[model samples]
Target: MSAKVQWFAKDLLIIGAGFAAAMHIGKLPAAIPILQAELGLSLVQSGLLLSCIQCAGICFALLIGSYVSKLGLKRCVLLGLSLLTLASICAGLTQSVLSLFSMRIIEGFGFLLVTLSGPALIRELAPIQSLPAKMGLWAAYMGGGVGIALITAPMLIQSWSWSVVWFSYALITLSFLIGIAWFIPNTTPSSQAVPLKSLIKLTLQHQPAWLLALIFGTYAGQWFASVGFLPTIYEQNHIAPTLAGLLTASVSIANAVGTFICGLLLQRGLQAKLLVILGFVVLIACALLFYTAKDSLPFMLQYVLVFGFSLFGGLVAGSIFAQALHFAPSPMAISTTVGMILQCSALSQFLLPPSIALLVSSTGTWLWVGVLMSVLSILGIVLTQRLFAIQPKTSA
Candidate 1:
């Protein structure tokens, strides 16, 4: 990569690790069709499979934060990547649905570790001037990785199988582990252990912490629920699988594009909260146009609207990451704050996909998905205002 691309070397490493982990996460949605065929998974089971990797985060984000802070970020990153490497390798060897579910749960723990610790690592290593831009890029990890995976998985699976895709991810994660070790400077793990009760008390005591977490959750719920099912949704409309994957991938990349723009805006000193509110406005408008007007409009128009929803909807993520740095109670509390947000985001991931799947399964249409997304966007708008109400305090 060019030095301009690696503006912050260590930050780039952390983002690279995150991108690989996200690819592991994103690989699943594209492979869902093959897994369903091979494993005989029901609609709910498919949704569960899509989200099961978040199960550990849902339950242990806060607790993991405390532990990771004690263990150190580098150690956490290595350990998490190792687990994913192993879990993906095992998943490639498995054929049974039960085995796949169990492996995903393991991957869940791995995903949680990298993501929760990554921002804190970036905050430590990044130059002051570059933090906002780096964080904005950090926010795009999921969308970018998922977008790439969505585009590539179909092509890979057509020649081979889902297991091969899983194996390829394992190799990729292993390569990242080696890169992180070689290129990233090492830091000693903290000996100090913040008591669990104290950590929770400190994080929960802050109002911005709660609001940030809620905002992240609501934003992530809509994003994941919609994107996770896009390929399937298009399939039902009789789009070719390759074409569907391409379109879905493009939508996700649009999210990353918006995130990149938002990052540049943050770097230029834009009001972070205002960006989030604008994002929610775009999300609501796009949802109305895409989800509600699908049947009435031409298919390509529907596609364009969904693309717009994701493109602007991405500003929420970038804004949230920017605000999160300011909202952190202290430098030490950054991981904790991130954990709390991820916990909320993970819970949304766990709940929203299955919930959306059930809605589609029960109602037999994508009509109400827009309504759910609209409600969440409205909630996000209300919550965004509260984020700016409190003057951000300096965290040591």
Candidate 2:
């Protein structure tokens, strides 16, 4: 195949991987309640499912970060999709949290494989000048998949059962795996493969990478804490229980829109630092409205506040990921850096939901949750904008 044709083929395969990953985010909400009730699990137990996904990512990213240059993208993605299929089916069949954890060990690694290679794959398939734009679209589509899953999964579970949720996601994984097997182009010329040796570099160990990791992690923790518990909160408020599905799903859609906007602006010379700064600004506004004005606001406005806050919040999740790819020391190192960032984000995903649940279980109001979001947002802003003179740009 011609170089252009080969690159486009590989791009499609990468896109399929992203679609599969995005769907996993949507699958969690529906699974949480079912797992809690089915296995007599606590909110903490449910939170670990997310933890497993990130855990695998963290470990694998370090081991395999630069492996793309050696193993090639097609082989790595094939392995992940196969594992993803197995994990989804296993998670669907398992009756206990123990079984779920066992299966998630597989799922988490699969996710890591997919994510760590994402930016590297894009770089291989697209021109150097198009990296930001391509990564942005990739982020949008991935976020959109999460949105689609959020909207669809709840209604299915409402009518069916929790097992159906996992099975359904399994189907998505299976289909994507097949597509990837059929169409992902072979690995093209590698730019620079980041070696594990450089991981020992003190400058990387110290400043920009870790600090940026924390910023992403904190922002994600606050956002997930809110999203993970939203269903229960909806139930508590006696609003439509489906509102959780609608809201989470819609926010995903909004996030996609935001990411897309960011991609467009980035192409026009928008700064990554500015986007991070603006994200915190929006999060602060959301916290104030969510805390102080929440009760007084009408239902529509409530939706608007949640949606608006989440739109930018979701943007942070995707765009930061894209940025990680951008700053990657080399193609081979994509997994290492992206894995670290995802690990931090995933740690936040693991910890915050249970923390918020415990607090709310004791305190009985979302008031303090708002305070948490505000604080995290401020911290993220400080950390992201620190030392780096360029302002992080926001997606739309």
Candidate 3:
């Protein structure tokens, strides 16, 4: 294919896969609670169900990067999506905790394949000029996927069993798998992959890559911290639990709006670093508005906090991922570069939000968490600026 044609085709293909992944992840909250209640699972067990997937994703990051030639991005994605579809169905039908745990591991492995290779393929197909613009669009799609999933999960659960929600999400994966199998080209390398240790060393040494990871981790931590408390805050203030879930869906979908807007901005010639800094600013504003205005404001404006928080939040999420991958041009090491950043980001996503909740308990308020977000977000902006100033052109 011509470079131009390949760029368009590859991006569409990647976005399609992202759409499927987003739907499944978005549905997690509604569906998991059912399984938890049904199985009488402890809090730790419930967390592991999610972490099991993260763990699988971690291992697949290295294995996929280290073996893309043998497995091929197309094959891996299709295989993973197929497994995801099956796993979703199996997860719905699981009769016991053990069976559910086994199914979650399968879902984890499948998700890892799809997530790691999707961006690597985009990096391969993008022309040098399109890096910033194309990446923005890619990020928008990921954020969009999250919105669609979260919004739909509640509606599905209201009318149908949570099991049906999983099965329905499976249909999304199945459709994506079929589309990918037919349209997306095989993207495996012909040569053996770089050694795992060497790939790690290369990415760790790449300043821009590591910086992007920190930026991603920082904003992701802040965003997750806000989002984690959003539902509970609403509930504590007397909003119905179901209403809180819907509110979560609203904020999540708003994140998609933020992503699409940022992507369009990048396409229109905005600088990536400027956008990253702007996102941090938005997050800080969101934090202050939510935390500082207890009774002064009317109910409606204060309630809009969720939308405001997620409104421009995704600008940070997708930009950093794209930037991290763009810092390296080697197809041989692209997987490792993306993997390392994602792994770090995933850690923050898992750890930081809970820590903030603990702060609320120990400190007797959400003030410390709010302060932590502001400080970290500021640091992220600083790092983004430094990286941009040092490596302006190539580190898109």
Candidate 4:
């Protein structure tokens, strides 16, 4: 194979690994009802199940990101996939809530390592000019993996069982683990170990990184809150499981499209700030319309609104991921900066779903979900404005 073809192949393998990792997340929503029925879980517990995959990232992403370079990127990626494969298998065998929850947290640790390392490895492989577009594609890993899992898990669960779904994901992830280990060359940069204090200080002091993290956090929180519980929401509304999975999957795939478009647009010299602001504006509109008008609007229209919300939210995420490469305080701090971003994003994902569940549980309605989304979108907009003010260069 030509060198170019080799690089492209490696990129696909890396992104595919991300997709497999995300399946562990997407597989759960469709299974929530099954879990609740079989495991005797309450609404609060279900919410925790949905968000717990982020627990590792919320607590340790920055720390792990800082040290991954020392550990070797390929090694981390392999180890992460191995953990995921093991966790999925163990989760499948678990007959109780506690064991399943423990496996999910282990899955979270695997997820954090793979995600924190993937982008930096991509940076090492891709040419400078194509970085934005590549990052955009990289950003789509979440939506793509989650979307496919959302659609497929329902069918698999219906035909077989949730354990089958978990085992199937384990097999898929294991295949990727082997592929990555065999095909991807070790691309870890040769660099002296930076002191932990210096890495933390440099990454923390980078103002743009923090703003970007907050922006990503706000967007991720609302997007996950809306999409993660979609299966349960549809169940309550008397929608068929298959149809609900399709709708939720479509919304997530739309998000993947938005992220890809953001990449192409950034490569074409569009401003990151403009794309981010546009995302927030549209998100606010969609959230308000979808949640408030849920009872009155046609189901198709409601789906369209949420689809738009996810799609535009992707733009915000893509922009942030692309910009993170540029905003790192130094070359050595890039992984740390990305870690900080994921850390904040994980924190939001960790907090928002359960909070929304609590609100919905107390109120006996989904009406206030929109209000909460709108508030977050507005915060996103304010943060975007401040981010651009501090670093006003238009080009990505």
- Collision count for each candidate, in order: 1, 12, 0, 0
Model 3 alpha-carbon miss at residue 325, Å: 3.9
**In candidate 4, what are the lDDT values of residues 167-251, reduced to their tens digit?**
9999999999999889988765547767877788878887888988999999998988878766555776789756777888998
Better of 2 and 3 by lDDT: 3
- My TM-score estimates for the predictions, one after another, are 0.92, 0.84, 0.89, 0.92
The reply for model 4, stretches above 4 Å from the true place, is 36-44, 232-237, 357-369, 391-396
lDDT of each: 0.84, 0.70, 0.71, 0.86
Q: Please give the distance, in angstroms, between residue 11's alpha carbon in candidate 2 and its true position after superposition.
A: 2.5
Better of 1 and 2 by TM-score: 1
Q: After superposition, how far is residue 358 of candidate 2 from its true place, in Å?
A: 4.8
Across 1-396, the per-residue lDDT of candidate 1 in tens digits comes to 976455467687889888888888888876877887888988889877877788888889988886777778898999999999999999999878898999999998998899888988887788778888888898888889888888877788989998889899899899989988887778677655667678778888988989999998998988877776665557657997677778888999999888888989999999888889999998888886777766677777878877887898779998887777888876677778889999999899778877887987899876798888889999989988888888887531
Question: Model 4 lDDT vs. the true structure?
Answer: 0.86
Sort order, lDDT high to low: 4, 1, 3, 2
Off by over 4 Å in 1: 1-7, 39-44, 191-193, 356-368
Clashing pairs in 4: none
Of models 2 and 4, which has the larger lDDT? Answer: 4
State residue 106's C-alpha deviation in candidate 2, in Å: 1.2
User: Ranking by TM-score, best first?
Assistant: 1, 4, 3, 2
Q: Which ten residues in a row have the lowest lDDT in candidate 1?
A: 227-236
